[model samples]
Target: MKYTFSILAVILSSTKILIAQTDSLPSNSIVLQPVEIKQYFNKQSILELTNSAHTLSSSTINSQSPTSLTSALNTVAGIRMEERSPGSYRLSMRGSLIRSPFGIRNTKVYIDEIPFTDAGGNTYLNLLDPQSLESIQILKGPDGSLFGANSGGVIRISPQGFDSANDEISLQVLGGSFGLFQQNLGINKKVNDRYQFAFNQSYLNSDGYRENAAFERKSFQTAHQFNYNPKGQLKLFAFYTDLGYQTPGGLTLAQYEENPKSARPAAGPNPSAVEQKAAIYNKTFFSGLGHDYQISSKLSHYIGVFGSYTDFENPFITNYEFRTEKNLGLRTFLSYQNNDLSLPFQFQFGMEGIKGWNKINNYDNNKGVMGNPQANDLLANQQMNLFSRTQLDITKNWVLEGSLGLNKNSIRYETLYPLESQSEGNIKFDNVWMPRLATSYQINNLMALRASISKGYSTPTLAEVRSSDNTINTDLLAEDGINYEIGYKLQGRNKNWLVDLAVYQFEMENGIVRRLNESGVEYYSNAGEMNQKGVELSYWSSWNINTKFLNSIQFNAAITYNHYRFGQYSNANNDFSNNKITSVPDWTMSNSLYLILAKQFQLNITHNHTSSIPLDDANTVFAPKYDLIQARLNWSNSIEKLRTKYTLFVGIDNLLNQKYSLGNDINAFGGRFFNAASLRNAYAGAIISL
Candidate 1:
């Protein structure tokens, strides 16, 4: 395997030199660089965008493998991972409010220009194979002129693909604290100058830190690219993922204080009181094709088309009630670039459509007594959106970008029980439009200033608008919002240091809030206007020193401050003037440091802190602030003769074993608390590349 890779590498290098010589331009003349075929693992250009964006390189991602993507991203500043169970994770930025625990994340997640989040705009990070990823780009703010829908922001993941000149294979096995285990294999091959293929597969399992918090997942990804000529390129890629997990139901404050390790049993005398022994299963598959065409020396065009489907099921502790959801979607985009314009300009347009079906069923003998209480109501929905954006270089050092989008949603509810009202069984939401604009000015070679203002909206979901019981009205309007932001970026000292600062304010009209009706069944309703304002700061620096034993030291830190309030509320039954919004923290911060030592070794340390937050609208329960720390050591070596390399890494998370709750929420069984802001965890892993 190693010899083959070496041979392929040699051939590719030689071919590249020959092509360069053949395409060489005249001496003293400016020459245009030839375009190379796109690869899944290529580094994304973070600095090319005028919007605030951050890129996590492959070097950093590789060091944190065999860990959840959520865990890895939590290290970033202004980013938070809110998780209720192994299968459910939410990525929040700048103190954004999280609406759900499952698949349709309010924040958009993407992979190589493809949307990974479901139709509802939610994403499941656990399902993604971290080993196959090359880099992660996080775009903050509503500058969706290039990307479409749910563009409050975007989390873009890039994968590793075949190198036309190289044949390579790699393997990895990892084990850690809490009975955790993982294995992965990858291969890349160049069939010829015109074709290349890559394959990757991985499996992971873990018995979580908290009792009954266990999970297992498997994933497969493949890519193939065809180069027809120098001016045109086409690539096809597909991915499939399977996930299963059990959740340790969050404990009440009393239960946590009594015995943090004691978990509710899966099967007990009272199913409602026991920990949830749930079976969660999901399968996602998607394929995409893209083409790039150079129309002329001054003009270029590109187009992409994709189709995808997702199916998921969750069975609760009662083993009688279960929920299943299926999604199918199609997306297409076209873009044109022109360098001949007065200033460089790009225009893009796209269309997206999705259909979703969801059902709740009863399998046990228990009737309305337990499980499938809402079995009578099933939902089918469809949504369509059209979007467009334009970007122009307004001046030598200033750029302007703008985007517009329109969306329409329709839903149909089927009722099995006659007692359920027809009004709650059929619903249609109004179409909404969003527009955003942003501008950036380069103050100098090392500093830039940026500002953006955008409008965003969240439509009501079937479950949010309709209920099994007819007590609540489903005619409430959709939630609408507007966001404004201003920020700056600085890179100094030969690019060894980088800093990003941003402040934002958001206002929501008719925001959706879950309310308990007279009969005690919780239902969703439009709440009064609300506002959230926050600031974020991130900094990173690397110092190289010539010393006897030390090579370099790197430090990074991120901090956020949020203020939330109700802008308007009028309830005839009660005075809610002093009510506090639920689940939002006032302050959050994270920091990390790395030291390069002698030999092939390195050390890392990290810390995170979050302020107290409310549990419910009434503000009766409060979760206090907490701190967590982690440490890691890594070593690597290469075998030149065999053209292979190996790396070994050991890590300890929550070195202090701090007992803290990162998130909590009201639940059907009881108000639940999420545990382990930092878990005392250890892991060791090795990667072998041939």
Candidate 2:
């Protein structure tokens, strides 16, 4: 990793040569444009943001493999996205994966303005094709003041051009190593000045690098917007996904080093992944409708209604589980602004509510066959958040803001299986208020300083409350914490270079952590106290060179340092006070370079490094450090007579074939810890524009 940093330093040092060469360039040289970041409650320029946020454009996403967002997102500091296997993803923000072993928890996800995360705190982020999104905005650290009940931060995913009125069609096909195949289709049409439609469809399948790790997904999405009134629009959208993946299970250190591509075999008392046909299957459909209206020049209202249904099944080494889940929700908000006064002010108030119903059944897995039932349970969950934000522009360059949210969550569960296991029933958490105060001062057009203090909380997700162990954890508590942060941003003279730096500390109580059982099943328990301190820094620059064959270049580098430790924790056999927090790396860095030559060819390169990670609270074992490199190349041409444009692209992952695990099982029982990642993989694809 030190060597990689040195390479980056060399690249940075060469900037002077490039700058000197470009000083007398022709007039056609490219000039980077200022960026706008919309992650805030109110739209603002990236330099004006008061919190830590990163934006990834569609071009950046496409620079990676056409299948997943893992590589593109990894380039962002403070965010971690893991794929234990294809189509199976787990996400974390600022070391929040401590409680999430398989799915997305503690975080809040939004597709456009719709709440995509269910009331139970689970997000099916893998359901969407990465290319379908126009951009992804991530707000790091806890931001419950406006998003509500999230300790890991917020992810705002914006789909392609909902407001654009262009009639276009495109198709893409891709094939890669390890029996990979994919197809994507995109369509957009402007029926008239008042009506517009956009649609996306994608399919992907892969026989993964390891045995019993095959995966497949079919996704479809559509959006419609109608301008019934001059000042308002009616919008409708739907998303459907049929996704399935095989779980290869975990391996021991010896097995990982010897045969990394092998599946988990039979242990002393457990069946093998292959023998049990370990896999997961899910089919979900979600839809929503909304109306946005401007009642007056100073006030506006927006409302949306949404519903979803999911059919999920999982076959594991120990059991076969089936679940049926449904969600219904509503969201409404109003905004008012007064810019005529000497000091301009704006405010937005909104409320979101959702109800979730789940029915789960678990049966014995007798060698790929489901036997007698073990547990049958029914559960219902409800969550509501009333939030508001007000911002004042005291002097144009100085901004002050205050935000608050009132959150309520409750859950009820009933067990209907083996009558002997009559656990608890209803559980309700008291209403909590989260408030934040922030200010940002623009010292000049090229520099800015910001600070904020906020309160955040996360309730136990449904999976955490009733884990695969078939036992209800009635004593589980919500984790609550306060975060204090200060940040700085600077841009170079020509706006070609931009830098962002943030430092923060968070102290939390009753932190949730994952626990594994003898059969590899998982549960959750509350760790007493934790202190998390971290620094995040990023630099980006883009400029066009003067050479005839060389066109433009973009470079970005980011790093995060975490000093997370347990403040108070103890169990029956150990007291881990002052120990390193589990599943967090002390240092992580990412760098990306994009180059365009002759205006017809392009190349993108990305590199990422992760330091050693503590695997448990005791800090006795660790996952060694590792690095990854991905590169892509593209060539484009146009047909003058056919009015068409096409691109040919090829990319490779894990260029060095480094041996490491993209995801790991923490505190795993029986020394079953490693989940091997793919090595030396390559992909190629073609895109046609019509």
Best candidate according to lDDT:
2
Candidate 1 root-mean-square deviation in Å: 9.4
The parts of candidate 1 lying over 4 Å away from their true place are 1-48, 95-98, 143-151, 162-167, 190-194, 265-276, 297-302, 317-324, 359-378, 416-426, 461-473, 514-523, 569-580, 667-669, 674-678
lDDT of 2 by residue, 154-271 (tens): 9988776476776888899999999999999999888899998889999999999999999899999998889987999988889899999999988988999999999999998888
lDDT over C-alpha atoms for residue 593 of model 1:
73
Off by over 4 Å in 2: 1-34, 422-424, 518-520
Best by TM-score: 2
How do the residues 546-635 of candidate 1 rate in per-residue lDDT, one tens digit apiece? 366766666666677777766666455655444556667777776667777777777778777778777666567778876777777888
How many residue pairs clash in all the candidates, one count each? 5, 0
TM-score against truth, every candidate: 0.85, 0.96
